[model samples]
Target chain A: MNGVKSESVREPLILGNPSLGDVSDKIAGIIESPPTKKFWALVTITSIIALQGLCSVAYTVWVGPGVWGVNNPVGWGWAITNFVWWIGIGHAGTLISAILFLFRQKWRTAINRSAEAMTIFAVMCAGLFPLLHTGRQWIAAYWLLPYPNQMQMWTNFRSPLEWDVFAVSTYFTVSLVFWYTGLVPDFATMRNRIKNVLGRNLFSFFSLGWTGSTRNWAHYEMAYLILAGLSTPLVLSVHSIVSFDFAVSVIPGWHTTIFPPYFVAGAIFSGFAMVMTLLIIARWVLNLHDFITLKHLDNMNKIMLATGMMVGYAYAMEFFIAAYSENPYEQYVFLNRAFGDYAWAYWSMVSCNVLVPQIFWFKKLRRSIPAMFVASLLINVGMWFERFVIIATSLHNDFIPGSWDYYSPSWVEVSIYVGTMGIFLTLFLLFAKFVPMLAISEVKGVMPGAQPKHDHH
Target chain B: MEEQTLTQPVKSESAETEASAHMEQPDARATSDPLAVMGDFVDPNEVTDAARAIHAAGYTDFDIYTPYPVHGLEKAMGMKKTILPFFSLGGALFGLGNAIFLQWWTGTLHYPLNIGGKPFFSPWFGMPVMFELTVLLCALTTAVVMFGLLCKLPQWHNPFQKDAGFRRAVDDTFVVVIEAKDQRFTVDSATNLLEKLGASNVRLVNV
Candidate 1:
């Protein structure tokens, strides 16, 4: 907690000035220099592969969503799962920036900028899924409205789908605003420092004419505190509502009250994992190691462990509740999930989310950056499988014996999944290369008082 | 540093000595400038009297900016939170409405066929979408309100012109700037008040 608190003090000083100082100039030089052999090769290969994936998405959108196979009982398939996964992956940023801020966690300063960026990018990836899933893809604007139709029918307000429309879109908008507001001062700092024409113009536009006056800062801090408070609940509620989508349903596994908390916990768990992954890569790529240290990774791992434990608790309680209930249908569904067609996926989820987190019990493992990185990646894979098992297993077989069907992804589904992965990594790489991967200003703000010392009682 | 309160009476000091001495009368604590009072004194021994007076009177606008954060300042100001949640709720509700609307149209209204013998309305299945949207909305609102309200988003710029020195908000410093609202807010009075309250070198910042 003290570590986190110190981060706030560090952020303002670091992030306060965006102008590429002597250090920033050095960073710019490295990224711009022509790579000799291995580095250039990796960059070229990655760009081509990502470009192809980009083309694949373009092709899918242009040619129709059918390029990815989703039909009938599995109308959602992996696309929705990916959407949930990506969106869930962003949970920690708002949680960190807002909840931790309110709690006075200063350690958040080092990670907030990148986490916020991750939130934006993850949401972007999440947004793509629905639009791509929409198939027609072009008339996405229609999804944004509530109209009075000639048939005299209005959209059902009770459905979770409608709630999702509002939740995801609103999340995207707010994250952007929050992220940009934080960036403005840094951008202004950058603008003020630039010696070149292009740099000045770009920075000036983005900085929004900031001068860092104390009054403006005071109000800005107030606004930030309020926003942080607002985002905290949004983090909890949004995931809970998502859980409701499954929980509120009559499907044997889906219809449970526990969905909201379970899903929200899982979202945060996965989101933190994603943040960890990106931050590690970013720190290495952008040379932000001092700002994002082992301490930061360890903290994130601790969160992952905690959330993972919460998820495991939920999982355990879920089975207990299911067995305790008199209903055979629900009991049978639980039995099927463990020993039935998708048993592998269910266990995979356990290993990833439940068992793997136990490793963090050792401080040495948590502190080992590479090990933490691996754990984060495994958790993400595990969480994805968790969603897949949740969606596919329950939906594939439930209620009646005769209605049972097996599900598997086709080549198109595989490619689309890969493509989304491509997009996620590509955006992340670009961000690592371009942006100040840490919240420099906010970290500087909470430093031990810079003012003249007075004798204290 | 551990803070100790000064409670000793100056009756032993001669009236002439007492006149030269700085002490925030427990009763007139509100009238003194806490910062300047500290500037006049160099000894840590004199601080207790200053702290007690600052504490007793409850100056709302003046904060204690120490080398580190003082643990219980918010309680001192009797601070109440500003309206961040209301705006967040507004954003969340908007998201919920959107989630319910979009899903209902596509699954139930746009192509209403009983697939899997499922009812036209599956509010449960809508949870994933709704959850995402709700979180999205709340986050969105938080960001917007944070800037609009907390960050003072569109105020354009800060009054502090750039000097390399002011950039230390991040690395090291806790600052308590006394606003004009302090009961003893006049430049001279505030300075005097700070000294009486045991503050050292209370500098007035105009910009």
Candidate 2:
């Protein structure tokens, strides 16, 4: 494993062959430096956008869901679609942090901390839609829980929507804990590096006064392993339960049994794309190209291509099932998606999700920075359309012909969605500024020649 | 954990004389007793060798601190496998039970509603909630127990923090500290052992 490096066999996880001290200096240096003008400018813009979203949410609560585009037949509209899209974007973080860790993919060390932060923030954005979508959000929010009320009313445990309340909250809490656990040692690194008394104290408190004792690392590794183990099924289940929100209903487009795997694949597909988009910019902005190498980008593109194909296959199977069942309503729904009122969204989903990723089959396109960046952005748009098509098209022209109507988002709805993007990016930028963008200790652990030469066994 | 001053010289060695000359102003909070004998090593392999030597010499109260978790260093130090998984299991069962009761009591017995005449309490529909709650409780419990009980962390005030050289352990240096509380420890013996094991920058510090 040591003599001569081979590219095909295994590329080095970190480039430039930096020493341990250099790793600390490079990553911690980002936090030590004052925020750049670009960072402040970006934050200001995102904060304004996020504030606009807050106003939209407040106005909706003051008025009602009537402010949005939903009508009788199109009761579930952009709100639900955005909720699923944001939640789907959150999945890639868990996949990179938990699933990849379990698979012993060493490259994850460079990206996991930031990816986990993205997961937490994306879930926050996702949770906002469902909370505010309810007309009387303040009273309706707690109604999802199985708490006793004055009227003796209890939540229906069988409802998929109620199940979503539990799944999403649990995902957020678990992800936060896992992310914090991974950050403790790195916090210690920050504590040691920061010269300011207050900054040092803050990092020290968060670091839990970590001394890096062998005894502590033993238990730390055990806790990390258990978290990764638990999170694997939890991440898969979170999306599966989200899919159940549709599959449990008798709607022709959503009633299929394959929604679970389909949604999970789409979640991972959108999530990796989102991660790629953020990381490509992050590596460039932070001057971390040596750590987050081109190989990492190439590897992520391959995963996106694979999952994109899975999403395409699911789309094909849905259409096949509709025609094969000999059910005219199901057949009409699929046909309507393709050629009816929302064919634009359907085609957009197919072209961006199905066709765009095909470029990754060529290694040059996969490895190219500009090509992958644009592809990541398009995939994000495509994934949003995928959810939009699933929810809007399915609900618009249902069994009753008289109730069908064209649905479009109000300014309020679009503002709210844009606000979520602002919220996500703002929180992410603040996190990137204050926190170590890479998992410092974990990256050091994976560096070539970081460990001892001898095998204990 | 006991603190007592060791004003008497441990040895007539030049290194001790140099370290003592360096300790001109100890922190007001630090005890005058020599808490541990310390060694700094840059290479992880050398630290692993030093840990093995110390453990083989039957000194149980020693620790090696590194910038990252070095492979095989824990085993070389003869540390025991952690029992965190068992606690995780306990938490999972507790959560599973909580979910079952929450669902069964709410759906079947308490204020049950007839939606499509579906069964009030089937494990199949309740599985998602059940699985999520289990993982949630298990993760929280593991974190709490690992930090509070096993690792005993969140100790912002530590003896090692008094020594400036100790800070380097988180960056590039590997630290081997043999506490004075160890059965085989004496300032002279510990310092001699470290130097004999090819440790550099060995020092005796009052923590």
Candidate 3:
């Protein structure tokens, strides 16, 4: 807002021998992000499909989870897999918005609006999973609180499921708060720019009467700093709790100390990959190349590379630990996954999530738009495989041999999966069409050599 | 939103001359030198230009204050970069101190309790609060420092109050004031000097 002051009345603020390259029409275009439409078709179709998936999920809740293919040895199946996949996708937004903000990474402003939107919507998708998986659709609220019914039934607080309610809700709330707070100032900018009467009012309502007063700017900056600080630890904890839902179980393969960090790293890795895939398309379609520069894409590639390596490490470490644990049952769980009925899924996971991301080590690949796109798509596929291997391998070889059975998803299961894809794309399409998917004002704040020569603070 | 061409008057201006002259005539008529006799007072703009010349000639005690942050006024007057970090440090230390003290009070001194064989006093668990406190303190301190600056807080009146409407610092006008308190400053000379510095307006404050 201080920047908005007319430079006319006085001479320019910094009468430096500065170049006009950064504040030119090209730079202005980057700041004022345009809309994209390429994904709109995909988003619409996905939304319809996701809505059907929602119906299937809701139907399963109404009738029971029995309508589909999950069974004794493979009780978790694609429902839980999709749950983990969606939750992992949700992780990147928080990391980008929170961690990068703390580091003063200005490039984060380019991707954070879309990323946070991704986080909120992905959480919506993630929350639906556990709700549907429970089967008792009407009784979902009971799980939220530990209360005695008329029959004096007390829900077990000791269960990791209870911890999940707290963790996921907290993560969602904090993320929502963080996302909304960042939007307020931008909303003020929009409010000031709107033309039509109703549109102006709507923008103003959300902007909360921000006047760009120094006092407000002071507090707004403080709150943002605090939220970023709060979100850093939060990003680590939320997925760790999700991982605990498996690791805390008595299941032989699932009971491992490494799940916490492994899950967190994989979440971040997959999240970044998803962010990359969307951002690349977003930049191209929206014509936001200036805001979302090669620099941003390159930085994301580095994270993907780092996280991909970490995810691969977790996989290897899990294999090594299972082999050395001296427990036949745990070792068999690992072996069964490699040579089991789902071995294709397991190998796909390893190759896509692990090997392909290594391409980013080449700076050319990271900087090249097409190369980054291909690598990002591969990372997502690899992440999905990672979840499939985790869920399928663990559920396949239970303690009883007679109860063992190979799990295959029915057409209904496949359709629901497609529906989720539909839902994700549908929402994403809307984001591209309407939202100012890039942070314009923040980008202006980060121009090199723009601040006073000395520390104004 | 509205495309208004906000072209304010260039250096040589209108009622602006009257506003500056009003602030200086009290100190200006002491000399009827040809330069001073221009109008029973050197027009405030002319003296401000002279002060800027003195500034370019390198004198340190002179300072500029505008109703708003001026673009080139600081360099035009040759002011030193301020020591806001001193206050920022004070704030950071304040936060660090608070976080440490809070943890000490609650964990070590307050009633210590054990839950699940965990120490009630693990300041480590309270690390989030401590971290938040440090940032909170530093941020608040910067505000205090800024207050001690631009507004010179606690006391309501400001030294920059050479003109009643100069309160436009919060909105528009940029002003430069040479203080009566500075050793290098004499009321008569400071006013005359600023008149020549191309100051759109200049004045001496009672400070």
Give the best candidate by DockQ. Answer: 2
Poorly placed runs, candidate 1 (over 4 Å)? A1-50, A58-71, A139-144, A147-153, A448-457, B1-207
Q: Which prediction has more favorable TM-score, 1 or 2?
A: 2
Instruction: Give a tens-digit lDDT track for model 1, residues A163-262.
Output: 6766776676767777776776566555544445676666666766554433344445555665676577777877776676687778888888888888
Model 1 Cα lDDT, one tens digit per residue, B105-203: 755767565555667767776665666676567656766665556545554443321212222221122233455656756667656667566544344
Clashes of 1: 106
TM-score of each model, paired residue for residue: 0.70, 0.95, 0.68
For candidate 3, write residues A1-457 as lDDT tens digits.
2235564553222122222222222322333443335355566567678888877766676678787789888988888888888888999999999898988776787688889889888887778777777777577676665344664433333456765765676677667777766665455455444445675666567655543333334434555665677678777877887897899888887999999999999999989989988888876765666567777888899999998899899999998998898899999999998998889999999999888988888878878888888888888888988888888888887888888888888766777777777777777777555444655445544544333333331
Can you give the lDDT of residue B104 in candidate 2? Answer: 88
Error of 1 at A455 (Å): 6.7
> In angstroms, how far off is A90's CA in candidate 1?
0.9
Docking class of 2: acceptable
In candidate 3, stretches whose alpha carbon ends up further than 4 angstroms from where it belongs are A1-43, A146-155, A455-457, B1-207
**All candidates in order of DockQ, best leading:** 2, 1, 3
lDDT of 2 by residue, A1-457 (tens): 2457766778888988877877888898899988999999999999999999989988999999899988888888999999999999999999999999999998899999999999999999999889887779878845787776787888878789999999999999999999999999999989976866787879989999998888899999999999999999999999999999999999989999999999999999999999999999999899899999988998899999999999999999999999999999999999999999999999999999999999999888988999999999999999999999999899899898988898999999999999999999999999999998999899999988778887554
